[model samples]
Target chain A: MGRWEPNATDRLVVAALELFETNGYENTTVIGIAERAGLTKSTFFRHFQDKREVLFGRSSLADVLAEGIAKAPADAEPLEAVACALELLAQDVFTPERRDFIARRQAVVATHPELREREALKGLGLIAAMTGALERRGLPALTARVTAELGALALELAYTRWGSASRDFTEVAREALDEVRSAAPAR
Target chain B: MGRWEPNATDRLVVAALELFETNGYENTTVIGIAERAGLTKSTFFRHFQDKREVLFGRSSLADVLAEGIAKAPADAEPLEAVACALELLAQDVFTPERRDFIARRQAVVATHPELREREALKGLGLIAAMTGALERRGLPALTARVTAELGALALELAYTRWGSASRDFTEVAREALDEVRSAAPAR
Candidate 1:
């Protein structure tokens, strides 16, 4: 709790991110992550199936995104609902305290192909989550999916800008979404 | 050629898809694919690094799409360039003779997580290719990426329709692209 993590999972993730950044993702092992976290090998195994799972945590962003979108005002449109979810992410997940570590983790992921594949799959999962959330709000399937892809693209853009921009994640994400809207090619 | 292919690579892809569908993807192996193709294990290795690599062949969609866009009329818009590329795919890759096999291959991929991940990464590759192609046509980076995403979404929709519809791939893809444009949220 002292370092902002309430459980062994965060500790393990933090330890793994450091080791991955320093020693390389390929060189780091589950046993090493466990030892670094001051936890046992069994604890690491209990928490994750493998080292790659460490980078993607047990936080379950799909659930988070879903919950955030669900909480948006009843009359909000699809993109507006998506905006609500991104704002919630800025508040809860992408906190100021975690920004440095998040940037570091991204750098580690960028250099590894296996990690990139996992990241891509995770992105698809997020988009699916947003799509379902939008559909539940009564948008048509195609509109829901298109809106979700745009939201996901904005999230990707804001993730890159969050650390660099003077603005926080919410504002950066808003700007990104606006950029997507303006840049979107008219048929 | 006995079938449509004059080379070993196409034979291996066809053989691998058959084996993956008959046996589960997890249960299939490189040796099995080789045996099914009537080629030696060494030849299979020479053609592909592994079983998963067989699904993603040396016939890269990125190169094909890029080449098609490059061949489009200089006055063609980004989406039009994408249409030209999809039309090229209809002519060369998604021929009537290969439709059944293509559908079979897609089904095999849908049920497997590893294959889905590969497909998602492959999709990212296609989007990147489209982005680069659009950028070379003088569009801005943001515009290029957004246009490419729309194109990719349309391509995805058309893929689900190509086998089921009475029409050929070109018409289906064009309609899908139009659907994407209309379905796109007005922001």
Candidate 2:
């Protein structure tokens, strides 16, 4: 057996996701999450403000995705760059073991109307960041916005598909991008 | 001058939006919103669950949008149907006065990370419903999802642009759709 011990933050997220999936989002409290994680309420508070934060604390992934977007080849077209960035993000962020957890997290967020609204805002922020990057590459405002929106939409669709199954996210994302390309009008 | 009396729900929404814009979301209280609307806290409770619901009580707008999707023309392609449905929704559901309220509500939601997430979830739910409607018209699951997502993104972009200025939403939405179409490879 591995001697690695899970950190308090990791344990809290796992426990919270489980409680959120098993019991219910509204019913799951910070105390319950902390106890389930085998930690004190103070420890949980140290990691997150409340139950809602536990599900959303994974926001670091957004920064990683942004970094991937920044690293796309300079010669790539706007759409191609976005697709490549999403592919990289899928490979790095949504590991196989995280698929089920993501699905459950989505389900929990879906069940709560407030949480759903928050999710949309987060998506819009990410798109805005991507738009800035595209603009820096000399794309026009409208074109950049559209490209970022398309990329975000494709990533969302691919994530949903991957979350619904056991497929690797990188593969699913690439396939989704291919599907989009094939469906587009021929050049 | 014409005598005008706003309904309780309308008054509440307007009051809440104003307060959210000026005082900020977390700082605005239910009692203050009720008082500004010329209603009691009890009356506010009769219409909504709590302070947060004052800004978010229009969940029925999703149903209205969904109905538009369901009522789209039978011969229309998936993207065309989605664009038309969103256009119809803008005309039928979101009026000029209501657009102001929506702008303020969006601003407040944007300022709060949690509220942003909740808004994302709501958009996702709307897109899912739109996807189901497209699927009923013979679109495959992935295609339906992508079309619906693209449509939703287009609508959001148009709404943001329209809400920022004095432009008509229906006109802006149609123009935004044209922009999306123009960006696509020639058919």
Instruction: Name the top TM-score candidate.
Output: 1
The best candidate in terms of DockQ = 1
Per-residue lDDT of candidate 1, residues B73-100 (tens digit): 9999888999999999888887888788
RMSD to the true structure for each prediction, in A, is: 3.5, 5.3
lDDT of 2 by residue, A5-77 (tens): 4597888888988887798888888889989988878888777876777877765656766677778898888
Give the per-residue lDDT digits (tens) of candidate 1, residues A1-187. Answer: 1333358898999899999989999999999998999988888877888999888966677887888899999998778899999989988898888788888888999999989888888998999999999899888888888889998999999998886656788889999999988886674
Task: Let me know the DockQ for model 2.
Answer: 0.29
Give the Å error, residue B89, model 2.
3.1
Quality class of the docking in candidate 2, CAPRI style = acceptable
Q: If you assessed candidate 1 against the hidden native complex, which CAPRI class would it receive?
A: medium
Cα TM-score per model? 0.94, 0.76
